[model samples]
Target chain A: MYRDPSDVNRVASLGAGPIGGGWTAHFLARGYDVNAYIHDPAERDALMAVVETGWVSLTGLGLALGASMDRLTVTSDLAEAVEGVGFIQESGPERLEIKQALYKRLGEIVPADVVIGSSTSGLTMTEIAAECETPGRCVIGHPFNPPYLLPLVEIIGGKQTDKAAVDWAAAFYEVAGKAPLVMKKEVPGFVATRLQEALWREALHMVANGEATPEDIDIALKNGPAPRMAVQGQCMAFHVACGEGGMATNLDQFGPALKWPWTRLEAPELTKELRDQMVDGCNAMAGDRHFRDMAAERDRKIVAVLKAVRDG
Target chain B: MYRDPSDVNRVASLGAGPIGGGWTAHFLARGYDVNAYIHDPAERDALMAVVETGWVSLTGLGLALGASMDRLTVTSDLAEAVEGVGFIQESGPERLEIKQALYKRLGEIVPADVVIGSSTSGLTMTEIAAECETPGRCVIGHPFNPPYLLPLVEIIGGKQTDKAAVDWAAAFYEVAGKAPLVMKKEVPGFVATRLQEALWREALHMVANGEATPEDIDIALKNGPAPRMAVQGQCMAFHVACGEGGMATNLDQFGPALKWPWTRLEAPELTKELRDQMVDGCNAMAGDRHFRDMAAERDRKIVAVLKAVRDG
Candidate 1:
């Protein structure tokens, strides 16, 4: 049964895994007809369940775009998913070969005008576009996790990605009620991940070195900039830290001290020793809680908090 | 006129100048003795007017720590400000020599254990620490702007810093109801600034190259992970991005792809032309609004948003 197609744009999530499912929820809740494709047939039910729950939450929050599961179609065929879609979000396995094959196939079947984006955190737009026939039409529309809630989508370009393609993807994401930032050029991990990795790497190093407890380190972020960062980006955050002097004043005063010996820039060789330490450290820190449960708790609180912000 | 020092633990901010005054307000409002240091001498009355306005708005929202500005002290003398004070958060000039001279004087007169912390964003802890005779004791308790609202404080280490000094400072901040994360080793820009700089550099590069408009870039952050990050750290944020795959699944799937040349690692040589483009781009994007007003608005919304989340 078809609802108003005019009200619901035809959108497809190229990989119906968890990220793909999130993409599905985001679009479907916004009244888009979602065509979700997943390689593993067994997980289809579970995936759909997640989508349903997402719809419930979105509807409760009044963010639901009046769409329902009746509009969602699950499939394994790439062509079936891509046909007549206005926007396509590919969240397949991150392997270049796998993505290349998938995109090459998608390029052949999907209409040329459709905006195709990859939920890749690592691969450059160039790498993703290399395999596509009309490389300029494909771009990276990397979103933060649980796309239904978070609004950031880093719009990056592959080597051959046309400027128009990036602009188109940004506009599409905006229309989707998503926040989209277009990168000047391709970069690993884009903006957010790279900043995060730097801090994470430092945390890992601290855990490895035994300078402070994991609890202490985590407490630092939870209690501090992580919250402020929710509102202000880093530079502005520091600019504020520097008070009226702005960044230049901050730099001239504090920049030289960074030359000390403590900051180990070289990535720790993730030897078995480092790996074991990480595994042990994280497990010990997390305790008996499953990561999924932890993630859910995180999401629930984030949603609750964001909702509070929205309402206030 | 003696205001009760007992209620003095309740702090009130007089000016919304930079978010520094807001940080001072955070401590005082949270049940600490605060004498807010407003830079403008003539605007003392005007500043108090500003503080009174915020008081009605903020306290009405129940943010005051069981007390209100009835306990606050507004003073011009740096010495009188810290007299009988448990902590002094000096967010004055960002100039190194100026701040150094101020802290040096503060070091000579203020009670030895009063825990002097500057909100210096980029200044090295070593240099700031060097101003005091008891060098190790002085530390940088850098907070993100809008500290009264957000919970991040980058506890940095300087050269000649004693281990206990960092701990003591951390403890003091924690007791003050702030989350203080101690950097294992001193890094330039600390953990947050460095990562933020990396992202900003890339953004500048994009603007210089004419890839995307500033509004589009800012929208990317505002609408996306900037909001999500309020609750979760970056590592976990990415974990969520991988959906239910958790960190392991996510790392496995996306790890290999990270090797791609997606990041503009080579620092953008900020040519004169590039710098001009960046300034112009950002200025046009920001429009005619004063940065301070812009910042105050951001903090107000942030406080509201965070409070909403807290209530939710």
Candidate 2:
């Protein structure tokens, strides 16, 4: 059953690293009580700042939220955060054991009806669900970063996951004003992450093999195909890009090029040399911004673009 | 040199198919003297009507030019269209031989100074330029369909093509209110079309292979990734989608899946079996709408979304 937005008395974020904090801010902005848990002491202030910045940005975008900033409660204890929560978002480290243990703890305490979701990139739900007593209650509620603005959530289920449980989580995300897509089965990386990884791997391989500059690869996507893709999904964009003859004609024509030597699906392992090359390429491609600052900057830009779309 | 919008006299479209007609309308709507040469007799009235309809749409969107509607001229005579033209756009069939022969004819008559461009999907400038007497002047000026609405033009050059020619075409398209991206080297399908074809081929393969239904595939993109992608380009979208860890972590953790069998690189042959599968799948997905009408309706919706972005 989907929790009514008005009925959500408390919301808990199990991991208050950058992403977890964002989730906390999202619930808080919507007037739901937030219990955010973070393990790293050094990260506490930064994560809190992230939540505040996100709240400020959302308000700046004129998004109406009836909640006050005081609704947020940050804690170091997981059980304290999970108590009386209608929804729990786990944004722990991507490691399987860490997630498994977190789910076990949360599953033991949170009400049986509460929805449990993971911010996992691509790890299997079957594996993650192994930690919970009510395994069926655990679903992959994968959200893109700065969760408040980017409206995407991949809802996937594991072998033991109940259909009702997945549906409940999906419904809750929808009520939270997030665009949620349900995956039929548990797949590694789910869908969006898988497609992205494939593209990223190829892009890196191009740099590793010296086919193109790191900057060119990014520019190739950003200034080139990216604009068209913004409006049309990759497949639909190709349907138009290849003309009305559609996928059949395009496949027939470009199918031979799939075997092109330039497209290196397999590159050398990321040894010290490869790592240096990759880092250099990425640093050159992205310029001088540090990762966190870049990520926050990206989130701000996403908000600006989303606000433009909303206003228009 | 950019074609002066105020000083523009004649605009020629060498092959006026639907895409060509869009370019034709773009020039005419910008108050230039538009001339088109189309092979099919039945296309004349329809093309003219489309141009008129496009003018109305542009005016409604507050992007209209003061050009008279009756100024659009369609003729069977290719020579007549090219005579004294300041700019030329070729949107003929994708057959390389046909394009080569047509370019030869165009080369003989069109003045040396006139900027000529081919809107060929995958055909490279090198191949098209080889047939021209003044090969150095030939360049690929590929535009996204519904050119009057989509502002992108991929300006790519062949080995022998002159840099001045590509720059001129870029400036002209910019003056005509289009964003032109220059490709350093000519590749099949250029940038947008290549990425599009790659994703499309995989999507069709997935449908053919029984992984997902057509409607679900469309839903997965439109409601989920496409909305976010509409704001950020694909690379940046991935940067955001990967959460706090960013592309490096995303690549290392999920990169192995690039070689996974999830994507069918070799699609099933387009036999009667595949045709039936596609027709049935798409028809069931689209429900009651005929394909042509559905395509037109889709275009209209895209125009609305694009106008939101452009005017917003």
Candidate 3:
């Protein structure tokens, strides 16, 4: 069952570090009572320090209805950390044995209904779920660096995971001001990491081949394609490329380039769902403008940008 | 010698298509007297419409000093268009024969001292210059789409091209309210297109695979990576990723990811120049703060964002 945000007043964060500390701070700043715990009691000072430092940034981000630093309860024992908590965020060491054991033990203590979110970078839920008796309660809540800062939280459910758990976490995250990207299926690296990996790899390739300097690479993005990305995503950008032609025109062009091996990657076959999504996104960004008119208007508005960076 | 902006008041546009029209509008809006010519006089009406339409956006972007749409003079004759002009921008078809023939003709009309810049997207300067008698006066001044708005103009010199011509074009572009991305050497797709191509290919791959819908892909970037890119480039983003360790730490972590077959594209070996550029770019972005501090600051600032997106 999808738990209501109001019902999740207290959340538990295990294995406090940079990500865990940030998550704790976020929960606290969002007016939730966060019961935070680490592997050992000796790291209490460091954990609190991370939360305090993170608090400054969170406060800057603006506090919620009852947000406060005082709402955080630091615990030494794992069971004590989970005490009376409605939700669990596991940010433990990225080790198989430790996490497998931790989840198994936590599963016995916490109620079967409570959803446990792991902040694993690469570990799949299928592997971690094996250790949990209530496997349905476990899910992946992989966050980018600085959890309190970056708004993205990629949610992926593995084999033996319940849809309810994923839904609960996604709903909870939306209420908490995070952009929860819930994947339909488990994909390696997820969407953000995979896309970033592709771009980064190409960048490295160019640099290694004496193609361009790092500064040169960065400046190009800052000035050109990235500004468009800042406003629109890659699919929409291609949609805009079609001028009045829309997605069909884009695909027509994309077809030749796909075969060219332009950037070392090959494209998957064009499915109807992907095409429809591409077209719909462009229409949304297009607003009242006709498909063709959107292109003219796009080119027009782009021609009229305010002096973002003035030259002396 | 860098020609004075005043001495270069009269500029010639050797094509009146989209790019040519955009260039004409930009020059006119920047207060330069422009002599614009296309292949046919019948296209004059169409070209002027493009400029007039582009002017609305140009005015919104804020016109340059003494900028006016009234200063544009459209001509059908090639010699008449280039007569007594300080600089000539060729916006011809991407055909080898057409560009070769046009540049050869324009080279004869304009003095050897007047720099002629080509708007060829992918054509090398070496190929285009071979057609020109005074190749020293020819250089690549490739502008991004919707040139009147976007500030980027990648300036590349050919194998036989003179540095003086490149320098003059760069100075002129800066004076024209364009970001002159002066290249150290010529590479395929230059910096902007290369990076864009890389990003675009991955987007296509994702769409083809049915792993995620197009809307999902766009939203992921718009809400996640693009914002960082809008404010800072990729190199700086990685520097911030190092937490407090800075570039050194980033490299250490990136070292493993680089080896991973995360993307279909393979990374070139990390040569010294590539490594140094990455480090230096990060250091520059880091500024006074050590790399570790940047991570703390990045998190803090991100936390402080009162809903990063305010505009509708």
Candidates' DockQ values? 0.13, 0.07, 0.49
After superposing candidate 2 on the true structure, give the runs of residues whose Cα lies further than 4 Å from its correct spot. Answer: A1-7, A40-44, A56-65, A201-312, B1-9, B40-42, B56-71, B129-131, B205-212, B223-232, B235-312
Q: Pick the candidate with the highest DockQ.
A: 3
Q: DockQ of candidate 2?
A: 0.07
Candidate 3: where are CA atoms >4 Å away? A28-31, A40-63, A266-289, A292-312, B5-7, B28-31, B38-63, B75-77, B271-274, B284-289, B292-312
Number of the top candidate by lDDT? 3
Give all candidates' CA lDDT scores: 0.58, 0.61, 0.76
Ranking according to TM-score, highest score first: 3, 2, 1
Q: Which ten-residue region of model 1 chain A has the weakest summed lDDT?
A: A266-275
Can you write out model 1's per-residue Cα lDDT over A149-200, one digit (the tens) per residue?
Answer: 5667888777787777788887778777777777755555666555454454
State every prediction's TM-score relative to the real structure: 0.67, 0.73, 0.87
The Cα error of candidate 2 at residue A69, in Å, is 3.2
Docking class of 2: incorrect
**Model 2 over residues B1-312: C-alpha lDDT tens digits?**
444544557788766565787788777776777888887766798677557645644454344456666777788888888877888888888898988888888888888778788888768778887778877778888886556545568887788888988888888877776667777555555555444445544444344433433333444554444444444444444433444444444444544555565443322223344333323332344456443443333323333333343343
Models, CA RMSD each: 14.3, 14.2, 3.8
lDDT (tens digit, per residue) of candidate 2 on A1-312 = 445644767888867566787787777776788888887656679778768756754554344357767887888877787888888888888899888887787768877778788888757779897878888788888875446545568888788888998888878887776767787555555555444444544444333433433344444554344434444445444333443344444445654654543233322232344233323333443355454343333323322333343342
Residues forming the 10-long window of minimal summed lDDT in candidate 3 chain A:
A303-312
lDDT of 1 by residue, B261-309 (tens): 3334432233344333323433443456554443333333343444443
Give one digit per residue, the lDDT tens place, for model 3 in A62-122.
7898888888888888888898888899999988888899888987998888889999987
* Prediction 2 TM-score vs. true: 0.73
